[model samples]
Target: MKIVVAGGTGFLGRHISRALLDAGHDVTVLGRSPDKVSAIPQLRGATATKGDVTDPGTLSGRLEGAEAVVQAVQFPNHPIELPRKNLTYDRYDRQGTINLLSEAERSGVGRFVYISGAGADAASEKTWYRAKGLAERALIGSGIDHAIVRPSWAYGPEDRALNRFVQIARFSPVLPQPGAAPQRIQPVYVGDVARSVARVFERAAWNDVYEVGSREVMTMNEVVHTLLDVMGKKRAVLPIPSGLLKMATAPLKALPTPPMTPQGIEFATQDGLVDITKMVQVLGVEPLSLREGLTRYIER
Candidate 1:
């Protein structure tokens, strides 16, 4: 099968590209920067094509002769700030997906796989989740064999979520958690997500949405402590009031690249748990626990 993975240079996209490549499928990574494809070791085997999903014109001819299309493109800095060129969730995730689906449908693509986030709902107040929900709806109604894989908070060596916490723990004697409330999350391994996506294509699970995640759920506090343990460091975790943290970082949003934003804090504190029964039964994958997954990157 000839597969085109949009945003294939990203963390999870690269993993998915590798999984498809290992399955003996011809893979093409469609992204804005074709040069960055070599940076991700997993995508070395994939043919890189430069294209911006935000611009429908650039997507033309990219999907030609492609049997399957994977909508993995996302705004790099999500939930924090708008991307350069005024790209928002609606423009990138929602409209970008619509553009790709349009081109793929024109090319008579057989399969369309979308990487949606957990807790996504068309009626949700959150912009990110709402955009993903809209995109999922578009894919299902596009008259193509589509599979939507909604993965929980995914983490790996190159992950921004847990890895940011690890970087903070490295320098800070005390780590600061957002809020005192127990924020539940099931952090799925990136590799597990990739394998599940591959299975979706191999099995041709059309018009279905699979929530992929780990079995165990942990709180924000627990996740931070576990990372500390994995890093072989002991840092007193201070659960600061969410309001105060947001107040402090409110001005940072003005910067081109803010380290943290209030919206990001809200997303961090929210519950991200997901039921993985279908991910196991359908995809035949048992995702690694938070501890086990963390151990792979953090040296004890």
Candidate 2:
């Protein structure tokens, strides 16, 4: 199978690219900076092409001779939108996939795989979920044979979320919890997400959306405690008051690449509910447990 993976240099996309390559598929990584593809170890054996999904003109002939196309692109700092720089979900997640889908259709692609979020809702007011929901809706309406794989808080060595906490735990005696509320989340391993996307091709007639996540649904406090245990570190879990964090992330809205925004703070605290019935039954992918996933990436 000849497949073109948009944003193959990204965290999730790189894993998907490697999984497909290991499965004997001819993979071509499409990104704005194809030269940086060499820096990503997972994209080592894959071909690189200069194409930005945000710019549809660059996508011309990129998906040619490709049997499948995967939309796994993310902005400069994922989950943290820099609207001033036009790096929001509306631009990349929503418009980017739409643009890539247009090119995929023109290139005669057979299958499309979209990496959607766990609680994506087109009608929602949230930016990330709404963007993903609109893109999913577009893909379904495109009348293309596509599989939507919605991962639940995917974390890995290269991930920005959980790794940020891990990095804090290594240097500080107290691990700062995002919010005081028990924001439930099912953290899935990046490898499991990659595997799920790759397994989508193994089955026939998979046009439906599949949600993938671990068996454990834990709170933010539990997640960090478990992550600490996996890293063989003992730290006090200190919950930051939501009001204080919200006030602190206010000034970040003005930065070029804001590390944390007011919206991002809310996004981090939201519950990520997932149902893996189709993931296991249809795709035959059972995501790793949160503890198992943390152990795989965080060294003890």
Best by the TM-score measure: 2
Q: What's model 1's lDDT at 84?
A: 59
Q: In angstroms, how far off is 231's CA in candidate 1?
A: 2.1
lDDT of 2 by residue, 38-76 (tens): 888888899999998999999998898899999999888
TM-score of 2: 0.97
**Candidate 1: regions farther than 4 A off:** 83-85
TM-score of each model, paired residue for residue: 0.95, 0.97
For lDDT, the strongest prediction is 2
Candidate 1 global TM-score: 0.95
What clash pairs does model 2 have? none
